[model samples]
Target: MTDILGYRAKFGVLGPSTNTTVQPEMDEMRPAGVTNHYSRIIVDNANALSDETFLKGTALIDQGTVDAVRGVMTCAPDYLVMGMSAITFYGGAKGAEQWQSNIEEVAGVKSFIGSVSVVEAFKAIGGIKKVAFLSPYYPVANTEVRNFLSDYGFETVADHPFRAPTWTAIAEITHKQVREVVEQMNDDNVDAILQVGTNLCMARLAGRLEQELNKPVVAINTATYWHALRANGITDKVSGFGRLLEEL
Candidate 1:
């Protein structure tokens, strides 16, 4: 018996409880008949003034991920899309692969990770190598993102770190701030620019930025959702989220 609403596919989206942006943003990218089931990883107080506290918060999210996966799996989703990126970026290229492998092993379905998904987006868009990215993460997490991208042969030309005070605060960052960072990261040398941190919500902004910047501006939420759709053989081109969803 096929699911009535989710007859195309049911995607299990894993994000942190504090993230307020994933649901609405991913939902906007959702194609007809494709439903997104979000399973939030519990993180009560994701406040951080130092690297330790930031990592501590992420540790809580990390620990809670397996349960989140199991919870989403109960819905019998055909695929899983990671709406959180920090843990997935940990341990570099091989680490990301192992991380995704573990999630897929437990989920009993193919999972799309932000880190891997962004890389795939690069490949799909083509002509992307030297990339700059902005993230609402501590310097430590930024390092992991840099390492992960480097392992995939994408040289990190530059990066801008927001270091949002708390997990919830990441969503509070203004579009102007993000646009300025993208402008700062953009130059003749950079091939593309990307925004990490799913809660930061750059899906809509990215599409507009691509037109303004005249360069690829990938948003994690958009890439992960696109990966989930394409990996599952759902090829409906979603516009207004950037070229990866529309053109690619």
Candidate 2:
């Protein structure tokens, strides 16, 4: 057996306070020798995708993320992993790059987001240009994600929104429902399926989803963790997730 901390790669994860999936799922999927720490943005409300919710969440996020970065930087982790998918794709390609830069500035180290990681994961498997997306956000958030992917040159061959507003509800959503959403899209043009919203539970079922879909289905949490580990030169492979971690 090998020592997990021998690799000594620390991951800084930024997620909503209500997010229960990213931390545990990422930890479980993470290979040996890597340690993960979390920072949370307060999201007390989840009604409409109104400016108020966005403002409050963003403000809380600013404060929370700074603390997270500072703490993680002290540990001198090789890379920072922004675990929130929504923030990554909030302003499209430019927004993603800007956010990554901000993380780098704050942490004084390189960073990657769930959105960017999944894109890289797809490309690693020779998947580029086309993909299907499944989101657990409302219409406004859904549109934002679609535009973001488009800006990155990924064709949104199909997309569907779960129309969920609250994080509690989103977290309650089962893997079966998630799989159903993917099946509903049924787009043959897409080379892979991407599911966003790290709050949702998908890591536990990532390998199963790929097996059932007969194509690559990259979960936000799984891909982000995978990329973060690889970015830090820790190539330990994990199991029970999907082909990406199993083979990448």
Candidate 3:
């Protein structure tokens, strides 16, 4: 008999080895007929958190990603979803497009990347123009995110960076810290609140905050997953992740 679970689609998710949030969050959002398979890219030098070091870490992630994708391709997933956000947001829209094209060329599969997914999510939410966001990145990465948004015609009204010293440390950020940042970023000027960084554990929090703020609060993991599903024509309205998945 054919397996019923994951019979509809299988997704291959790639993330950093030090990340502890993406897998669990993605697992929570999975529907009955969908399955997610993950491959972790190595991050051997996860010391000192600075713009330079963060970029170096991203380079390391890039180095391992092709191999990781090749390994996961054995599963023959219907699509690829990048569970990491920093690399995707590094070079704005054109850069992200090139990155996705390269990955697809290597893996022989289409992908829903973090940077592109966020842009699409904002568009789906009625073309939200102004946004505030939080990230567990260094100042340089934050700047890249802002630039990325700007390229897509979205204005960033406010942003907060956790500046975690190591990739592992990113997962240690407390939910209390996230709430405070969300509160700081929330205002009438911004149309939405966005949370980048896959290891920050903001999926459920984004959902709850959306109800409180009466605006969209989106986590990267949620956006990427929702994008992958919808791109493949899976319109399953997943609950408890956020309005992006539940209502869009």
In the order shown, the candidates' Cα RMSDs to the true structure are 0.9, 2.9, 1.3
The estimated TM-scores of all candidates read 0.98, 0.88, 0.97
* lDDT (Cα, tens digit) per residue for candidate 3, span 1-248: 34467788989999988888999999999888999999988777488557788888888888889999999999788789999888898788889999999999998889989999999999998859999999988888999999999998999999998998888888899999999888877888989999999999989988999999999998999999999998888899988988999989
Per-residue alpha-carbon lDDT of candidate 1 for residues 176-216, written as tens digits (9 for 90 to 100): 99988988889999999989999997899999999988999
Instruction: For residues 87-135, write the lDDT of model 2, one tens digit per residue.
Output: 6777888888887888788778788887788778877877567888887
Query: What is candidate 2's TM-score against the reference?
Result: 0.88
Rank list by TM-score? 1, 3, 2
* Residue 235 accuracy (lDDT) in model 3: 95
Q: Model 1, stretches more than 4 Å misplaced? A: none
Q: Relative to the true structure, how large is the alpha-carbon lDDT of every model?
A: 0.91, 0.76, 0.90
Q: What's the candidate order when arranged by decreasing lDDT?
A: 1, 3, 2
Residue 45 in model 1: shift from native, Å?
2.4
* lDDT score, candidate 1: 0.91
